[model samples]
Target: MKNSTCLLQPSLATTVALPVIYSFLFPAGSIGNILAAWIFSRQALTKRTQYIYLVNLVSANLLICSTMPFLTVYFARGYQWTYNSVPCGIVNYLGTLIMHVNMYVTIMILSSIALSQYATLKKNSDAQYSQAGNENCQRFLLKKFRQPKFAKYLCIIIWLTVLCVTVIAITRNARARTMEESPRCYNIRVEAGELGAMVLATGCFFLSFMMVLLSYYSLTRHLSEIQRNTCIEEKHLIYRTVKRNIFVIQMILTVCFLPYHIFRPIFYVMLTNNDCPRLNYLVEIKNFLTCLAAAKSSLDPVITLLLDKTFKKSLCGLFTRSTSEQHKRNPDIFIEESPDT
Candidate 1:
């Protein structure tokens, strides 16, 4: 059983080949998240609830990536079981917990942001649509979540549910371990009979994916309406930035995250159905997909800044503060000041 479970551990070759996948990601994720946090600290971002979610999402990614060093050790050490499994289990558990929070919070934040943008665009589209009863619904959502109390309670609920799911996953993995494998560090080895949990995850993933798509669709529709009804080309710079950000969000969900989500149900279902469950090739594919999943932690900050113009501009300001400050000084001060004195 120990050896069989070790089969779930990635081979030395795979780990070696993918060192950058772990090592490079950790620093990039850490720096990106830290910068995002700094950007959020600006007073301008304080008003919106989506900024709160964005900060927490960045935090979750940071926490998840912090465990990469442990994973790096495991991978770099020829995939051998060396350290105490307790810490390994801990890192493993945290990795999953943060991953879950990151995914759902991203869906929640980005979709709401897009929806808010849609509402804004709709309000400016035409007098007819802006005055309609349907506009009230949009306006209500925009304001409802803007309230700190409402957004705070909702965020607490989300974190609590995430904690519950993580505990369950850790408990399940713990209960399945035999004496031999109980004390060894290894890769994520899922066996049969995690379908209920997987189903829940699958449901959440699909629902979030659909919501994101719907929000983007509504946003684009309103944007088009605004263009037709107003001078879009004149204000196209503003719209263009938002559109680019939305495009990056779509790409992240589709390119980085889609495969793992799409394959998760099928992988578990197949494992449950097969009596032996000895598909080496499938395990390799799972590792590859999981690497892509791991990349999300690094990519998320990039996504956040890519999507948020204000945050990007704020971050840029921090780096060039001295230059900006110099520009603020009187240009004449540098022109023969000694002669004037």
Candidate 2:
């Protein structure tokens, strides 16, 4: 373990860039999510099922953002955090709790959103054409998922399940650091149980990815059927809108997540072997990709703006109102001139 620690010290770039990135992400993500929370809270009483997911996503992002200062401190000091101090333990606990929770919870929630949209499309099509005549309990459950009550319950289930799983995983991986190793916050040791859990988590990601794809495919085919049967010109616009929705989620997962998950098992193997000559290089890449994954918290506000029309309208209205108030307060400084004037 001591030799592996010596060989896998974070590179200069990793130490410098990760702290800066986390510092920026901390403020940006906090402000964005706070604004989102305010906007969503105003509309909470409207019983929009979509708001359930949006609110939960914002909550998770805020939690993740709150952890960034600690993370910045960790990386800024080159992963040396007073070795087994209370703050170090707190940071490590959060790394296991909120960080991992947000990633996997975001995955499941986004997949749920895609599947919900697909359900909405199916319900609308069934209503219009009168073809879906209640196949089974699964069909009934899908229909139920469209309701706000169902969505709220589902969100609770997701949060509880993720929290329980992550807590268990962390407990299983916890160990005491020895004096032989330099007092460092991070090292290249991978427990067998943790590695297996990580592999299982990666498989969940793939399953969620396939769920989104299946939702997109189902929606496209259903829309095509509608166009063929009724020849509605608006179907083209709806198709494009759905495509954009799927594209946004897919882009987030692919850009922020795929690289980390894809590299994780390989990184684990390399770290575990201790004989890998390029371990330090891999460690740098791993840290950078982990930062990239956390970057999604800062990017999620854009997702809310793109997907929620009311969020955009509320934000625009707030800006417009502020401008009008400013103009009213400074009437003497500004004047409109007509050609006659």
- C-alpha RMSD of each candidate structure in angstroms: 8.6, 9.1
Off by over 4 Å in 2: 1-7, 44-46, 130-138, 173-183, 190-193, 322-341
Estimate, for each residue in 56-106, the C-alpha lDDT of model 2 and write its tens digit: 888888888888887887676635654556665676667535677777888
Clashes of each: 0, 0
lDDT of 1 by residue, 107-170 (tens): 5555554544444444444433443345666666655544545555666777788777767776
Local distance difference test values of all predictions, in order: 0.58, 0.69
Worst lDDT window (10 residues) for model 2? 332-341
TM-score of each candidate structure, all chains considered together: 0.76, 0.84
